[model samples]
Target: MWSGPPQPDEGLPTGLSAVSVPWKNLGPSKGHRESPGSLVENPASRKEAQGEEHSAAAPLDVSRLRSSSMEIREKGSEFLKEELYKAQKELKLKDEECERLCKVRAQLEQELEELTASLFQEAHKMVREANMKQAASEKQLKEAWGKIDMLQAEVTALKTLVITSTPASPNRELHPQLLSPTKAGPRKGHSRHKSTSSSLCPVVCPTAGHIPTPDKDGKELSALVRAAVEDNTLTIEPVASQTLPTVKVPTVECNNINTCALSGLARTCHHRIRLGDSESHYYISPSSRARITAVCNFFTYIRYIQQGLVRQDAEPMFWEIMRLRKGMSLAKLGFFPQEA
Candidate 1:
């Protein structure tokens, strides 16, 4: 065959010439895989490959990560510390609350004890007062019963005396000398006999004075003496005088003074009776009569006290009346007109 020229051997060593092969003759064939060492022949390429490998194998920035982790741990520790502080503060507050409650409970218990003791003392005092009142009431009841017994005995004795007494002449038929007038008699118009008669009247006699016997018939005198002795209304005693012989004169008994005074007051206050009329009428106005009746009632109360009918002490009725008159002016008491 005719070659174009003498071609150098290209497939030989660095000094060998290139040998041209026909491109159509090169068939399809598997290419051989090259090793990394064989592929990286240039210094620059080797450096590049080593750089990539280092980049892939290199670990993360350990210093930065360690710093971040430390920061996170510090933050967590701070949070924990804050929580602990809050818990301690809450515990302290709870302790203080508990102490306050304890103090309040102790104070309440003390007050309750004091109240209980005071209530107990008050109950005891009430019981004692009730006992005293009961004792006093019982004593009063006994005294009242004793008084009733005494009154009954006195009534029985008086009834017995009345049954034994002799009947006397009519009270009206008794001489004016024997009967006493409530008011003062005329001073100038009396003869000696009239004066003697007035003196002999028992009602006119002073409390300390002796009553002379009336110069009446012996039968009448004996009857009067007998009546007086039996009635216990008057006491007759014989007194020897320098001028006169032993004479029996009538004197008011001390025990009968209250009865005599009451009778005298009643007589003085008696209603006016017309001679032929059965009805009696007071001369004074009703108001004045009421006042008189009040006075009589007051006297009656005093008499009851003196007679031991009531428990209260007996004040002198006349003294009280005088005190009332002195303390209360007529105008103030409405007795006289204020203008007057």
Candidate 2:
């Protein structure tokens, strides 16, 4: 073929006439017909093209997203487990502390109870001792009161006896038969002259002053004595209680014994008579005789007082005692022995 510029369709020669061709016929030949617009050719370009096609056509990867979510969940579970372990450990420590405190409280309570019981026991013992002492003191007080009451009653009885026995008869006289034993006998030089006789007599009268008056004749005194014997005013008894031990007492038969006879014939003479004798030595009932002797002894005391044997201040008491004893003898029939 000649290589030249082609003619237009309207001006082409007959040998070289323009042909009518199909649109497919415009493409290159098999080797060269691969136009860039028609078919893919470069390998990099094909891969790019394939990737774009996959992107457009493929579905989402749901399995990969699910695996990633599982990994995150496992990490959160481990964190929560660590926090739970810390909380459990704290709770255990708190429970142990609470138990220890409870034990300590129990021990304290037990000690307190023991102390309280001991104190109560001590208090009970003290109260019992005090009660016992109070009872003992009360008993002693009652006994002392009883003794005082008895002493008062005894004193009252004695006073009543003294008051009841005071008033006496106005007329009473000594009996001849009751005269002193000395009068029945003769004096020392006259023992050869007389014979003596004795008899018992009874007289009852109140105790009072019935002293014999100064009179030459014994007739009035004798009549009064007879009246006194009849009156029965004097009553003699053994002392109610014996103050002195071992002594004889005058008998009822001796009641009429004439106390005035002890003064001898001269009424002023104080010498008492002994049995059947004018002399002083021969006596029955020696103790009674001694008391009578003591009255005679009073004259000596009076003499000694004048000689100042006793102090001047004490002399009055001696005279008063002597006078009282003399009076008492007239009343009581027996003498109270005067102290030396």
Best by TM-score: 2
Error of 2 at 100 (Å): 0.8
Cα lDDT of model 1 by residue, 18-80, tens digit: 433232222334685555765455456544544554444333344556778899999999999
Instruction: State every prediction's TM-score relative to the real structure.
Output: 0.32, 0.34
For candidate 2, the lDDT comes to: 0.40
State the C-alpha lDDT per candidate. Answer: 0.43, 0.40
Global CA lDDT of candidate 1, please? 0.43
lDDT of 2 at 111: 94
Q: Encode model 2's per-residue lDDT on 1-340: one tens digit a residue.
A: 1124323345333333332221222446677746675554544654454455445433333444566678888988998999899989899999999999999999999999999999899998998888888888887876666556545533532332223233322111232322231222223332311222222222221122223333323455334323422332211212111111111122212222333432323221122222221121111132343443344334434544554444457667667766756754753465445423
Q: On a 0 to 100 scale, what is the lDDT of residue 12 in model 1?
A: 34
Q: What is the C-alpha RMSD of each candidate to the true structure, in Å?
A: 22.3, 24.3
Q: Ten-residue segment with the worst summed lDDT in candidate 1?
A: 238-247
For candidate 2, what's the RMSD? 24.3
Clashes of 1: 5
